[model samples]
Target: MNTTPISSRLHIAIFGRRNAGKSSLINALTNQEVALVSDVAGTTTDPVSKAMEILPIGPVVIIDTAGLDDTGELGELRVKKTYEVLNRTDLAILVIDGTIGLSEFEENVLKIIRDKNIPVIGVINKKDLSQYSEEDKRKWEEKLKLELIEVSALKKHGIETLKMMLIKKAPYDDRELSIVGDLIKPGDFVVLVIPIDKAAPKGRLILPQQQTIRDILDNDAMAIVTKEHELKETLQNLGKKPSLVITDSQAFLKVSADTPKDIPLTSFSILFARYKGDLEELVRGVKAIKKLKPGDKVLIAEGCTHHRQSDDIGKVKIPRWIRQIVGGDIQFDWSSGITFPDNLEEYSLIVHCGACMLNRREMMYRISYAKSKNIPIVNYGVLIAYVQGLMPRAIEMFPLAKMIYEEE
Candidate 1:
């Protein structure tokens, strides 16, 4: 249960107007005081998430966000943050204030949710306080053209029915898009080339590495972990030819050199490029590198925030490499963590992190947004492989991606 990463879990976000029983719905759903309850207009200023197992639905992350109707300068900021939650939200629960009925705000929120193609559950909260009857409920259902579950969160009424609805609407097939599982067979050995550098976390493997190893095991494949330097030795020591070799983007040069061409080779970032985003599109973005001029802007986006290391891959290494390849004072911009810049049209290209910390929805949103803006976007792995002149060999395992690279 604890093994599931939050990023991988089903993200169910509750959104509504201030004092709309959003917090109350969260608490009742979890059967605990997971979210703060108050008479105040805005108790949850930021998105707060709790990970737990809802049977039949399995492991999930429930997010409670600030009300969309929050006002004032600070409240507007809070509301903006709440909207950002939609980027990562897998499923949404739009809580309607039973007394107030559906307002323009709720209708607009519904529009945005529909626009994203996210499956949602409409919940009419504070049901006990409302004088509305069955006919009114039918009216809401007719108005929205979707089922609405009425729940008196304060009274803990209809919570079970809501949970069942969540189970029915939940997306359980995302795990089918494995990190490294699909490439290897049950008994095949897969080698991982991880480099423990200054940027490496002190005590444990990073999220991408950990998730990859777990995916291999889950698929009943053997995962052989080794440092980038020991990749040659590890491959030699294997009794049989391993199915695939996955390395960190930083070590693509050395690892690609060590791994035989006969064996399929790729990187964690590349895997995530496919797992979390569009692989073929990203592969196409690599060609944009050749067109970059000195004065052109490149946006480096990271999904997680951390202390910058002397040779941090996102901050230092990527920028330095881009300068070396593209040359001559390219205006490099950086954005890290939750908020992705809306002004993508300002950049010629976007170099994104592996995005292991982010869920698929958010990463896809960024990729699609960049595409919509007519800006080329590529991830750490694909860009590194491209720059190193080893992209063909690195992506040979995936025919479609390789074809895209070849065509570009």
Candidate 2:
């Protein structure tokens, strides 16, 4: 459980005003000094995240954010950062000070949570102070239209009840989708084409490849892994057609050429696009590539930060391919991890990575964010397919996405 990726865990963010005991509540919840508790008003300047296995909730990433009502110039920046955490937050814990009662700042935060449509649990801390009563809880619950839980971080009272409420209210989606198992039956053979390049992690396959193999095994299917050069021979020696051929998007051209036309072909990034993002919407966004004009601004965003190889895909290959397709130069901007620009209107298109390191909710938030600004957004795999004139084949495994691409 400790080895679980932060992206795969449930993200529970704590939001409140200064000295609302947010840090103390986090410490009590995890039974550890996960957050620094201080008497100072703005000790938590940025979002501090900790990944742990909470009972009844399994694995979760608990985030402690800055106070919502921070004042002054620097405080405004801290407050801005707090709101940014909301984009990736799956569930929110809005902590209120029992002594001060609820304020407009807390209400404003609640409104944003409601607008985001994520589940939230209202917590009234400092119960040991006796400043708040049951009537106060009832009135606030009625006014906010949310369930309220009382807890004393200092005395640890009602902590168990808060945990129970968290278990009951935390979003639980039982329908866990598979990477490739749903598309293939038991005993079916699937071939994976991975390229061992400078960017490849030493002595190991990337996370997506490892996860896809695990999923195949879990479904009672067989997964044959090989490099791009060995893919042709591996397929020839199998003596049986594979149900699907999934390859790295960077090696799409070589893998597609080696595999038979009848066999369904896709990429790891494409699978993640469907699993973590909106495939149909991304496919629709690919059409915008053909409409690119000279001097247009394009933003390429990656979900993880890593040292760039000489021929990095995002920095080198993608730009070169787009220029060749457009027959002219275009301005390109880059961003990685959780630092997406707020002024998205400046770009004509936004190309994002597979987002295997990001949760489904965060990926959807990014896609929805781009859409709200009327900017077209495409994923790495879909963009590679479009540039290589294989968009239809790359998404063939996803029938609905393929149909949508064909129609466009």
Candidate 3:
């Protein structure tokens, strides 16, 4: 359970003003000192996350953020970070002090949560010291329009009820989506082409590759993993033709030539674009490449930060390819990890990574945010396929996406 990746767990965030027992509540919920507790107003200066298996809730990532009402310059920065956590939050716990009740700060936070369309449970902590009356609860219920759960985090009172509320209100489905399993039938063989370059981890495959193989096995299909150099040999030695050939985006050119054109070919990034984000929307976004101007700015966003190798795709190879395709000077900007620029109007196009390190909610949030701003957003795989003149072939297996691209 502890080995589960953070991206695979449900993200639950705790939000409130200072000294509202937010940290204490987390301790009580987990029944461990997972969070630092102190009497200081601004004890938790940054967001602290813990991935644990909660009974009834299964795997979950509980994030404890800074107080929403923090003051001073540093405190304001902390508050900003707190709000950013909402992007990936699957469920929220608005911890309000029972004695103080809901103030302007709490109301503002609630409004932001509602704006994000995140499911929430209003928690009135410190119930032992200041028990909230039924009338108080009714007023809050009417105003907030959400179910309220009263608890004393210090004494562990009502903790079980709070756990039950979390189980009931969690915004997740029991049926999980597949990466590529649903695309093939049982007993079919899928070949995975992974390029072991400098960007590749020293001793293991990346998350997307690992998850894809697991999904294939779960569907009772065979997965053949090989490096780009060995792909031809692997295919030639196979007793039967493979159902599909999926390659790393960087090795698409070589892999496409080596594999038979009759078989469907795609990249791991493209698969994640559909599983984690909107495939049709990304397919449409690829059109922006053809409309690029000399001075237009393109934003390349990555979900995780790592040391850039000499031939790094996002930093080196992608820019070179864009320049080659556009045939002129183009401005480029880069962002990695949770930090995304708010002023996106300057960028004519946004190209994002596969987002294997980010949860589905966070990936969708980035895509939807770009769409709301009228910005064209494409994924790394889709853009690579388009630039390589293989867009039609890359999406051949996904008929709807191919149709949309053709219509556009």
TM-score of each: 0.97, 0.97, 0.96
lDDT tens string, model 3, 1-408?
886779989999999999999999999988889889998999999998988787777899999999999999999999999988999999999998998887778788999998999999899999988856899889988888877888999999999999898888888655467899778999999999998877789999889999999999999999999999999999999989999899999889999989888888999999999998899999989888879989889999999999998878899888888888889989999999987889899998999999999998899999999999999999999999988888799999899999989994
Residues 1-408, candidate 1: write the lDDT tens digits: 678888788899998999999888888888889899899999888888888898877789999999999989999999889988999999999999999887778889898998998999999998889987889889888888789998999999999999999999997664578887778889989999989887788899999999899899999999999998888888888989999998988888888888887888889989999998998989999889989989999999999888987777777877888888876778889999889998999999999988888898999999999999999999988999988889788888889988888883
Q: Which candidate should be chosen as best, given lDDT against the real structure? A: 3
Q: Which stretches of candidate 1 lie over 4 Å from their true place?
A: none
Q: Compared with the true structure, what per-residue lDDT tens digits does model 2 show for residues 312-374? A: 999999999888888999899999997678989999999999998888888999999999999
Error of 2 at 297 (Å): 0.2
349, model 3: CA deviation in Å?
0.8
Poorest 10 consecutive residues by lDDT, candidate 3: 169-178
Tally clashes: model 1. 0
CA displacement after TM-score superposition, residue 42 of candidate 3 (Å)? 1.7
TM-score of 2: 0.97
lDDT to native, each model:
0.89, 0.90, 0.91
Clashing pairs in 1: none
80 Cα displacement, candidate 2 (Å): 1.3
